[model samples]
Target: MVDNRVNPTSNMKLLLYNQVDGRCPFCGKNLHYVKNQIQTLLEIAHIYPANPKSHEAELLKDVPRLSEDVNSMENLIVACRDCHKKFDHPRTAEDYYRWYDLKKELMLNDEAKSAFFDNNVEEDIIKVMDSLLKIECESDLVQLSLSALKLDEKINKENSFIFRKKIRDQVVDYYPMVREQFNELDAISPYQFEKIATQVKGCYLTLIKINENQEAVFRMLVAWLDEKTGKISSLACEIIISFFIQNCEVFS
Candidate 1:
């Protein structure tokens, strides 16, 4: 039988390496080593066998595939040569699922990271952050009852209990002030609040397209806001994201 394997392009190889952060996804070994000079030990392995023998094909016949196209980026991963060899010669259903799941995670992470470069929120969000920071008086904050919190409705079941609690705390503490800040901004400059809300919505849309997981989306929104606000305060960013969630700007 003719071998159908084809070498991935230079750009494809680079992308595979980057998706796994220059380490073997299977073995956690560095994809390259610099002994005398740079020596690459990475091998691109297909999640779905490119040219499977009859038995290999039968073993994975019922398993879901990342891509029908054998060499597509979705079906490829960078592994150390040892893992690549081991994964190919004796592929099992368990191994196939493991590799497929790992590749999917890496792809999602890459997409989330890429969104940081592709999208930017309005700078006015920083004003809201400043307002949050200036709340010197505990009486200044108006906490909403847990029954009124929107996070319970918007957060998915897949999210951890701790994350749910953290978001709940942020929203309960900061939602009122954030909403007030937006109201003040709108009163001062008509549509300024709308502009920021729309930008946050846009970022959320981009993130959901990458991964529909609520926890992942929420974390990405916080990270994106942190980046946009010059990394001033992660807590401030989380509060702002929680405000958006409550205001129906995201996770709806």
Candidate 2:
């Protein structure tokens, strides 16, 4: 898990946070509306609740784009006295959705849309979306079909065909539109399917590159290397450094 106390880069903080008075972001409601109190003033609302377990009770989730410090400028959203009071008591699941629907209807801004999606798809649901997209665009019909059959055989060789049908059923249910596109590919040549498969995979990776996770993994590896010694250890670090350079080469 990442340390949750450090503020993100200064440049990013300014981009997300209000510069003046930092009152309620939506309506610009004064921070000290009633008594002009400092402590009772606005508090930073963590867009995504950091603690998932406490999230159901609190109705907040950690926003990946925000800094590690949950209260940092990037994570903070100033809400007015009225809005803050309403969120104090947890709303029911139905009520929460209803409230979100009304809020979304009233404010069709970018922030509202982002907040709505962030709360609804609370988890790392984007990964599931990406996986479904990949399945839809997959070609190499012969190879794909063979691989599916092999997987089914491993699960239950006695009912391999039935298992295969289950996989196909899942794909159709996940992407009904893609199912039609996939059926059209059946008339194409097997070699063409293989070529298209390679292209589609490349396109999919480009669409949603998980560079942040890759960077975190690399950073952790470097930290591990620093704790070790020997010429080979130094050489290993050199290779990792080179890998990063090559990884960024595509941008050049």
- The TM-scores of all predictions, comma-separated, are 0.51, 0.24
Worst 10 residues of 1 by lDDT: 115-124
lDDT of 2 by residue, 5-88 (tens): 444565544343343235565566666544555444555444433343455644433212334555555444446656645654
lDDT of 1 by residue, 53-133 (tens): 999989989999888889888989999999999988778889899999999899889976764443323456788889888
Off by over 4 Å in 1: 119-252
Query: For model 1, how big is the CA root-mean-square deviation?
Result: 12.8
Candidate 1, TM-score vs. the true structure? 0.51
- What is the Cα-based TM-score of model 2? 0.24
Candidate 2's error at 205, in angstroms? Answer: 43
Q: Provide the clashing-pair count of each candidate structure.
A: 0, 5
